[model samples]
Target: MVENLTEEILEMLGNESRRRILNLLSKKPCYVSEISYSLKMAPKVVLDHLDKLEKLGIVSSYEEGRRRYYSINRNLRVEISITPHRFIASTVSETPELEIDEFIKNMENLLKTPAGSLREIYKALQEFEEVERQFSEILGAVSLKFNEMFERFLTEIEKEVEDELERLVLLGITKGADTPFKISEEYGISYMGVIKALKSLENRNIVEKLENEDVWRIKC
Candidate 1:
């Protein structure tokens, strides 16, 4: 039985920079300077990108004198996942409890059968003991994608808020004891701007009101 290799490989490959490097290497082998020139990036930047791809075993390199040449390792097999930046290894094995070997072999053989048997094929898959493992893997993949998406979204939101706050301070609205609405009014800002800033502060848990409870303040 083949063990699942896709999940681990895909997780590592999901980095945009790394994926770009991999795609470049797949076409043909190139040295670092050649890659940097092709990608229109600095050699150090290319090295960082290659470091990640190499760690995932997607790319390999060998020294040619003082320089190294890298190439895509074609032997690596990946099972692409439906979700973005995710994949499962083609050689996934079922849990020990499942009678998987023969069942998988049968499915592979029957895959070419007529479309009329699709329902029966799905039913058979459901009945297979290894189906549990497949579902678990799917869930794991979903969770990973969600985490990555959430992280990127959070970073973008943080950057936007920081820029907004700088703008607000320039307009003299970073004063103490002013409610967000009051600050917005004083700075001639729209209510939406105030709301967004307040929300950002709340997310960072940095918003604090004075002892009077009516005065809005943010911790430095």
Candidate 2:
């Protein structure tokens, strides 16, 4: 069962667009237009990616009046393992003991409370501010972990590719040089060299050009 699920998860994650969609949905629930705008993808393309994610059970959606909102399935936690013979993928509950339903109910009750005395309103505001602060701290921790993982992944790639030019191009892209021309100009490398490195990176799926655009971006 774990092997089968791993294969399915790998197949679903093979597409860059789907992975991007999942990343966006993980942060917040969003409508198709919002996702399209954020990812610089066409609405139709965004919808297609969302469809695939929903089918894979990684994302779920609901219709709100005329718009549909999509969100990640936060309950599902994916784990990957690699060995000499095979790779394994598995899923587990992210927070099996956390009563998210009860927390939501409490939050809803707080939101529905009517404004009362000035002191009462001030206390409520203080509590909400504290909650916001806690959320910020949690988000900061997640961001830090993500950065560490990205750096480690880059280090592994650096080991596989020994060419200095390719490494420069990758570093440039990581630092926000989206186009080969920009990378060349910023790094003082020849235009042809930047282009050559970019092609190699694309072939290795390290970076990709956005559809209908001249810009290339690192596929993180």
Who wins the TM-score comparison?
Answer: 2
Off by over 4 Å in 1: 1-5, 80-220
What TM-score, over all chains together, does every model reach? 0.35, 0.44
Model 1, 11-118: lDDT tens digits are 766777667777888888889989888878899989987787777666789988787999986465444434442323453333433577677667656554345587
Candidate 1 achieves a global lDDT of 0.63
Clash number by candidate, in order: 2, 0
Please give, for residues 89-195, the per-residue lDDT of candidate 2 as tens digits.
67665555458778866885765544698877787778778886887688557656766776886787689678899988887776677887889998999999998
